[model samples]
Target chain A: MIQKEYEKNEKTVTVSVVNFNPVWGDKAANLQKIKTMVISASQEGSNIIAFPELALSGYECGDEARRDHKPCSMHEEAAETIPGSSTAEVAKLTKELGVYVLFGIPERDEKNPKVRYISVAVIGPEGILGSYRKIHLAPPPTFTEEACFKPGNDLPVFETKYGRIGVQICADFWVYPELSRILCLKGARLIINCAACMVGQTGPEFIAQITGCRGTENFIYAASASLAGKERTLSYYGRSTIAGRAFPSFKQIFAQGGDREEIVSATLSLEKGQPPFDQLSLEKERIRSFELCANELKKLAESR
Target chain B: MIQKEYEKNEKTVTVSVVNFNPVWGDKAANLQKIKTMVISASQEGSNIIAFPELALSGYECGDEARRDHKPCSMHEEAAETIPGSSTAEVAKLTKELGVYVLFGIPERDEKNPKVRYISVAVIGPEGILGSYRKIHLAPPPTFTEEACFKPGNDLPVFETKYGRIGVQICADFWVYPELSRILCLKGARLIINCAACMVGQTGPEFIAQITGCRGTENFIYAASASLAGKERTLSYYGRSTIAGRAFPSFKQIFAQGGDREEIVSATLSLEKGQPPFDQLSLEKERIRSFELCANELKKLAESR
Candidate 1:
């Protein structure tokens, strides 16, 4: 295990979203590309930098039935263990830059090296803290996640000096908002989503719209990084975004173009504070009020 | 009861959202204004037209403690019983136009005329269909609804010739995605939202964003009508919108301007269809997959 070192000076953390398309099934090249981004993001003063889903081996792997598909040839061959090779290199970079990095990778199950799981890993200067598996698997034929990988079962919130961070893979972030709500209930102040969804197929406007609500409704900071350009037969939607509470009232705070590979960054406040509109607060008291409202409705329903 | 008549012609329903500014606490004037808008919506072939929260009496009502306040002077005077003078007139018009209308009105509780509930009533050629009381109440100072109106108890889905419909008031639509989910589970094919949220306070972008998600996630059509212009200290954000599942995809189909009075209309297909991305489907099979994923996470949590 390597020692991890983080900047002890700041409470305000600048988070960066790296939106870039990777060469399908190429691990060495993807890692090399991300290393350069980490250096650039660090130079730009980002305390935490995040990348799109499956950034290590790309995201064009076909479903279980199509495992032998062209792009996925690299999935099994390139699958790496946590401390294997990618994180070791990422860990060194984080230590040197004093920045934390979270990126997606296709993990090879330890007991059975042939088995792979869609996963995201967090690495600091010291070493790899841990990883979160993609809980929600996209069904075929839009996303073949379930076809090739075993779905992840945990919704882990990583604790840091700045705030508690919760992560969700691409499709997991959509449909089931319960994932985000539960994360917030568990004390996560910031939610990060890593995705490699197709571009023109699912418009960036739609992604931005949903991403914004997740942040505002939960009264937490949300940052998403998506793959840009093409990933095999699919074209990725780039517009990576970072949004905050709508109570204090703000617009599209940080967003990237749908057609481009770019890094979007913003400084987020993680301190527990009251919203300008008390009605939008995510505090326990506010949650209690909502419960009371629910109870009142229950009584009314019974009476009716 | 007067005889009612409606055009029994088509399965395709054209929904209209009436976005307008209401005179504070003036029910008669507001009714007159809506009458004109309903005629226009009918002319555009809309079978169903929706109006903003308290469209008949305005939404600037202060809490019970602040009833003596000037804006709320009409609460006692303006409160009317359902199927009262207003609905009687509205029903006549619905029959004449051959259309269904959903609008907000402050209802004088039948058992106790002194008490009122923030309610939305549905009227067709057959007269009053039913009503939904706002299940969730916004707390002060964003809104003092809880201080005045009792929270509603039922999530009723009204069955019509075209499709099943669900109603949610302003604040009820936000915070709880479960409200929409339950309506969908109960077979609502269309969800209507009536809102009078403040302009600069709750950004139009936020409202529009959340409204779109409610429709897409539920695989149902969603329409929102919000009050425009200034009422007392609050200026309503009036971007009435109509959204549906992008069929084979997801996005907001039609939306109106934020600071204007207008009717936004869209003809939607209510037939069960697959999402643009098959993985995005909300059908029972897909729902079951989500349950399985959730169960897996639960097991993982227990192990940890």
Candidate 2:
């Protein structure tokens, strides 16, 4: 196993993105798959590894093809509570490998087990750091994401050895640019997105374009992990990627191509005042920009 | 000239993006070049045409190579007032061809001619509709945009026979995505971006990515015209492009390659409720998303 030591105050961390296909409603099988992938990524010297959305139980939501889509009630059977058995299992692996892992799961509400959220958990060497519920659910008529999961409310930025980081679910990150902006404003230097995205008319190219824009616009490092292969109702596009902000110049340093079930890794130097990021005062500029459009945006919200 | 008839109720408008080299500090020569390009674009059946930032005087800012960068004071000599001789000349052409045009210029203040703004003007057949000043200035250490021109204040959306439109100058569009979001929310079906961007490590690919995002995110058509060829201090990547928003599936209907001087046109069907654009409650969703990040965004602004 390769274990590269980080220099003092340098704050360099290796991140890995895993693209794997999960069998729908198969929690046991998916957990096993994640265990193997996490160990392998850790062995490859990755300090952090991310899995696709609903990785634990697979993306069982119905798409256009499945007319008589199974209701959210059916999928609730696969939901697990945070720090439950599945997280416990991953926690053991994180402890052994000394690596941080972020993976998606169908989360059951503590007070109401019937309520579920498409959620992602952050696991560190010590234990579960935190979790993010998927906000900005997928639009209806085509897919039934709103029918299956309850939306997340809070935007959380977790403290890590490398830097302050944030998590966003697939559609939440794809639907609009606000989630990323909020996370970055909350002091997130890097954002992790977990998705089980399907290939649409534009194909995987659309996702790739969105990923690049998210990183560039927010001036933050972004690591996105997506699923590959066919599931029950839809086929997933496997193009997990990680992009970093290049300094002195405003261009994105993106990881090349990987459109299949594979692990992609890149090292990030957590130094201050880099290009793109340093070019503008992040929070200040975002606030000003947001303020400029505050009235219009408010009107837009009311109309919706 | 090729004048394709528009179908009843179908708002299909053709847009042209021009990519050309501008002669630094030469208003007359640049104006002549624009006249030729506009006629050519009109002949090709384009109802609207867009030119690069500072196309009238070229991007004459200093880079590392240019040891003695000219002051914005020197360039102010080239600045002209709106509806001045140059815009008047373009207005005559627009009236003759029955086409709407947008192009970059160093704008002189009417009250204080000494005050200049990095601006782009929108001209219809009748006369000048309005203009947008560069709101987000380039960082001084890299480009001396701040020292040269005063920033613009208001965001104006123009109503035309084609549709509602908005304009943003180079760095303004590149810096803050809020400008595009606000314009789209304010009923701008199409946004015009005029840029005199320099070639960077990512080359034309970076600009292409940003263009796609600006269009897709707002669910609006976006056309970006950038300067091509070499200037005194920097070499520009002339990859002017016009991207259409595909309905039902948020895929960006992008126009092909642009690394030379040419007019690329695409037909936009003014159909309501298309993929992507038609998918969600745009204004409402934007309002909610903006509200979700309002406090955080405000904090960011205050921090700045």
Candidate 3:
């Protein structure tokens, strides 16, 4: 396996987010585009490169199938298994480039071929690292994921050479704050959101707002890669962002993409030392309050 | 009790937030200032008015005693019982004005005199409606609440003439997102944050960022009333704000105060109809995910 040499002098990782626009339901074409972007980003010295949610099959592929009154939706028709063709292709590319890559796909369950999930696969030079299925499926009149996709149960953090990283899909990052907090408590130093934010329904500003808060509140680095351009009736607002604290108390938007296809990268320092006195105290208090918060959440779940 | 007549012509309720400056450890003088503001706000036709956290006894009263190396801190010396003199005074003012009022105080536990909590009291025309003791305490190095204050155990929602309202203190609203979620689930339409945001440690923008998220995410109205001006060595950044969705998908800052003493008010319509299809689906998904989220939180707390 070919491994790219990272600088041993500095504890920094350069992460890149690709604001991609995929041809609807065209897996082969999308994979070729992804391969080119991944190589370009790798050549740019990015340790980790990420793509938008459903970058392989496009976000509105299922909607098109549903609208056409097809017996099987495009999501089912185009769904790939974890170690299947698409992932193996990306895995091969990563092995050659010697960089970690993350991109979204519709994963077909091996046993139950009918069941599918909105998932992001993380691949390293060694091969398929892991995949995080989108847990919070977007529901209802605006966008319908629940009609076709099943929600994932576990919140898993992937071990990486850069750091322990956690991946979350679009709505999961925007709506639920607890998911990120849980990821933070589980030792995720950097969180990546694979998103496909639609225009009108949810804008880029809202994405930046919640994304920045998640980063600052948990005191962790966060990056989001989004799908730009249009997919059938849905037009995506791609303002992919990387947010972290520049100073200890202030959150800074390190890099942000515009409405068009582009790449945004930021080098984040992973050095650890004793936290400032205020931060230490705040962290201690956060841990202390977790039990109470957990109990309340349990009660809320039970009541529901 | 003289009840203020509310207009039944419309479904709107005017809520006021007082950006206050309190004299350190001077409860009597502060109460007088509060009374004056309450009357002024009531005259301006506000159904509810809120004051900053620890408005009565001042935010840095304990720090003063700590600095002086006194045996008993001002927080201990000046702490009042919930049904104590202060609540009675506020009750009288609210009863006369026939309006609802919320203000923070250091509550001395009736059972245990040594125990004190950073708490907000909600008083109505009838009397002292209820009080929400701050569940999350600010820890050391920035500001020390854990040094003298005990964290509250309960998250309570009080029913008022306008609607059901919930109260949270400074750190509780800023740090813990689940606390507001629990309150929202328990039927709180309006969440009020009583805050003492310090100048250097936390600023106005950070307060606004989290406050807006809490409102927009829950699809509920949120307001923060904060302590302004200086308190000994600490200076408070007072950008008190009220936030809610102006449009269905857009969260708007309805009203915001400056860095000095002021009262900001906004009229919100509380008419409940069937939620939009998008909102309905989102709420359904949120409820469905609660079980999985609670389990994760439980595991996280256990790991610690």
My TM-score estimates for the predictions, one after another, are: 0.86, 0.91, 0.90
Using lDDT as the measure, the top candidate is 3
Query: What's the distance in Å from true for residue A62, model 1?
Result: 4.9
Query: TM-score for model 1?
Result: 0.86
**lDDT (tens digit, per residue) of candidate 1 on A31-122:** 99999999998998998999989988878774534653222556878777887788999999999998889999988888887678888888
Tell me the spans in candidate 2 whose CA falls farther than 4 Å from its real position.
A1-10, A62-70, A247-249, A276-279, A298-304, B1-10, B62-71, B247-249, B299-304
DockQ winner between candidates 1 and 3: 3
In order, the interface RMSDs are 5.7, 2.7, 2.6
Worst lDDT run of 10 residues, candidate 3 chain B, spans B1-10
For each candidate, what's the DockQ?
Answer: 0.29, 0.47, 0.39
What DockQ number belongs to candidate 2? 0.47
Per-residue error (Å), model 3, residue A206 = 0.4
lDDT per residue (tens digit) for residues B52-108 in model 2: 888898877534212444355446678888978899999999999999999988889
- Alpha carbon lDDT of each predicted model: 0.73, 0.76, 0.79
Question: What would you estimate as the lDDT of candidate 2?
Answer: 0.76
Which ranges in model 3 have alpha carbons more than 4 Å from their true place? A1-10, A62-72, A273-290, A297-304, B1-10, B62-72, B273-284, B297-304
| CAPRI class of candidate 3 | acceptable
List the lowest-lDDT window of 10 residues for candidate 1 chain A.
Answer: A1-10
